[model samples]
Target: MTMKKKKTIFTAVVLAVLLAACVAVDLTLPSYHIAVTVIKKATVYALVAVSMNLLNGFTGLFSLGQAGFMLLGAYAYGVLTIPVAKRASVYQYFDGGAIQFSLPEIFAGFLGDTVGSTVGMLLALLVGGLLAALMAYLIGLPVLRLKSDYLAIATLGFAEILRAFFQWNALGPITNGSNLLKSYPTFAHATPYVILAGLMIAVILLLITSTYGRAFRAIRDDEVAAEAMGINLARHKRMAFIISSFFAGIGGGMMAMYMGTIAAAPFKSTLTYEILLIVVIGGIGSITGSVLASFLYIFSSEWLLRGLDSGKFLGINSPIFKNGFRMVVLSVIIMCIVLFFRKGIMGDKELPDLLDRRSRKRKKEAAGK
Candidate 1:
């Protein structure tokens, strides 16, 4: 085999080993169920972080409303996936009685037991993503015209508008308004979510590594200069926005499936801010950093913050921290990270670079020997 091929094989083996080790370590956490749940949630957030980074990080767009897009995706996926039989019992908010659709026999065979439900769920998610991209394209026409704070407000307004629109009874047939959609699929195994997460990560990684992705970076660095250099700024900007929104929508659908319940209010500006927090803490344009940060942020909130807030520290009982303390602490941590470690943990660098460096060092050491 060629030297390059050998090195590639070795790298893949090493990465697989590392991944297994990490999973093993995660399994050893104090609460296995909680650990699994946190991981599942993190996977969804990781997708969001990557999507947001694609625009905010590489493309230099300060667009918000990520949460809104996610909500849209979640609802889209939820409405389509609930089993026909259980629709009446589960979806008390709406009456989607007597639905019918047929899947190909091979796909049905491959999906096995959950074929019908899973396929519906997948279709919903796909549709949600497409819808989000459509919304982004439409929204971008007007919102992208603004820059900086104006753009932020416009995007924020768009999210609010979406929330309000979803909450309105006129669209209740589709959204169920404020009523929670029940009888939805849960992350019982979390395998589907994990798979979706993997696909999203792969797509983002592939796109960001492509020449088009570099163009996105150029537009982000200097829109006017990129345009002057013969790059289609508007086209690229719109593409980034649409693509980011697409994934954000998918992430939202994943969240809905994982949570099994969602409310429109919770998916507003507050969520947008939280995602931004994760993105910033993870590093603006770094996908690896975003993945790590998503895990850190979600796990910290679920495990660490919840424990602290519940006052369950070594059998102690006191509410000294009080409510909202978690947010306060999170805010402080974010401030510190931003102030002390401005380039984010990874900045523009990816995690694979570290592994590459280690591999080269080992090769150099062997040569010296």
Candidate 2:
């Protein structure tokens, strides 16, 4: 078979195995299993990390406002999806909030509950993405001009400000005023989460391979050179920011669903930093690296390391291994990964690229022999 056909087969096999695994996970494992939690969280993080990578890695925009955009997405989804019947209890302080209708309810009236809820939830997620994109466009107007650390700081500050704004009592009618947004409908299994996140990540892959993606890379390489080459710097930069924020927002909506509750308290700078760390660990400019690294990071931190915190780690129950100690070990492991793989696990090249390169290398060796 030709190289392209072989690559196609390989990709299909990998995807089929993954789909089977996800289905098996939900069908076989308990809903509360660590594996389920890890799958949900990892997929969410994978999408957010890739969104951040689109800006920081592909576009060379140093922005630190991911958590803020995510907050908007989370709130947007939560505020819109809370059941009409449960609104009174959920919004106890805000007179059931401004919106009276839920998307799922409207759609469910026509379709069956299962399909309607899924469709409505998807529309809400889309709304979240659009809202984040709008915010990004507004913010990018002023801060996108700032270079490097200044841009990062500006974006970070804005994110903090947005988070605070969401918590303001005056907006409580809609935002719930520092309270948790709960009772929002969510997928009961990890399969949907995996599929949704995977689809979005696939879109990112397509974008990265598109002409605009090439423009993003050009700008990342050198703005002056790219501009000289006739790439519209301002337009492309704004597009990149908006597009990145759109996906981040979707990720945030997914995050809200995964957690079953969300408050402004958790969408902090630290959250952005964690996603950034994942991106770095995966490789700055590698999508496959980001996705793979996200799963690894979430799995190890949330599952494999849980025993360390609960005094049951490694068959060595000790007083030293207490609450939060797992984080310490995880941190050390991350440091080691960073130190050893400075270019990250995949670097800029993708898995397919690596596979092709290896194939050619082996063929050359065979020819020499």
Candidate 3:
């Protein structure tokens, strides 16, 4: 067999093994285990970061409206999947609630309880993504006309406006008006998350390798030239925006399931900033880098540097170790990376690309010898 084919089989086997191990851990270990929680959060963030990269990295659109799309998705999923019996209790403050139905229950009637609920949850997540894409299409019509910082500012303002709108008292009946949305269906294990994220990312990779992907990269490199080359710049840009928002929405749905609650408060501009930072740290144009950085970011922030929040580490207590110290250290590390490794950890390259390069280098050395 060819070396490339062998390598492909090896990579597939390794991934399968890792996935099996993860499922085993999820089944055997407690749900509250820190590692388990981190993996879940990382998986969600990885999806969102990759979605953001699809627009910002490939299409060269500097959008900051991810939080808005995410909020829409979270609320959509939460509102639809919440048990019908719990609606009155959840929306007690909003005149006994506006929505009196449960999507999963509707599906349960036809598909049986367990399977129906799962199918309904999947459908609800899809609805969330569709809603987000619709919003993106509406917003992108005018916003895409702007360039660079102007586009970013407009999108950021839109997110803030949407947040405020969701919190408005007039929208209370539907949105719960600043109150938390809970009692929604959620995944009990990590296997589904792994599968869903893997599938979505695989779709994204396929998109990136297609003809449209080349057009996106072309526009990213030189918009005017791409336009001159007969590419419909506006159409391609809008497509990218809508597609990115769709995935962002799905990621948000996953996050809502992971958290078991949804609130407009958490879906702020800061959330967008965090996702953008992840993309930058991961290598803006590299999906593998985003996935890798997601785990690293989650681990370091949520686990490794957790001790910095307290005054103890490695059995040593120090005055310097205090609240906010972790963020300070993380900020410094980000700054160092920006200054020294501007292209980020992967630098617009995938793991396979790196492996191929190394293999070629070794072959060249062998020939020289």
Query: Which candidate leads in TM-score?
Result: 2
Measured over all alpha carbons after superposition, the RMSD of each candidate to the real structure, in angstroms, is 4.0, 1.2, 1.4
- Model 3 scores a TM of 0.97
- Candidate 3 has its poorest 10 consecutive residues by lDDT at 6-15
TM-score for each candidate, following the candidate numbering:
0.86, 0.97, 0.97
lDDT of 3 by residue, 80-170 (tens): 9999899888888996578888889999999999999999999889998999999999999999999999999999999999899999988
Candidate 2 lDDT over residue span 55-134, tens digit each: 99999999999999999999999988999999999999888888899998889989999899889999999999999999
Off by over 4 Å in 3: none
Name the lDDT of candidate 2.
Answer: 0.93
Point out where model 1 deviates above 4 Å. 1-32, 90-112, 314-319, 356-369
Which lDDT values do the candidates have, in the order given?
A: 0.79, 0.93, 0.91
Backbone clashes in model 1, listed as residue pairs: none
- lDDT at residue 5 of model 1 (Cα atoms): 71
* TM-score-based ranking: 2, 3, 1
Judging by lDDT against the true structure, name the best candidate: 2
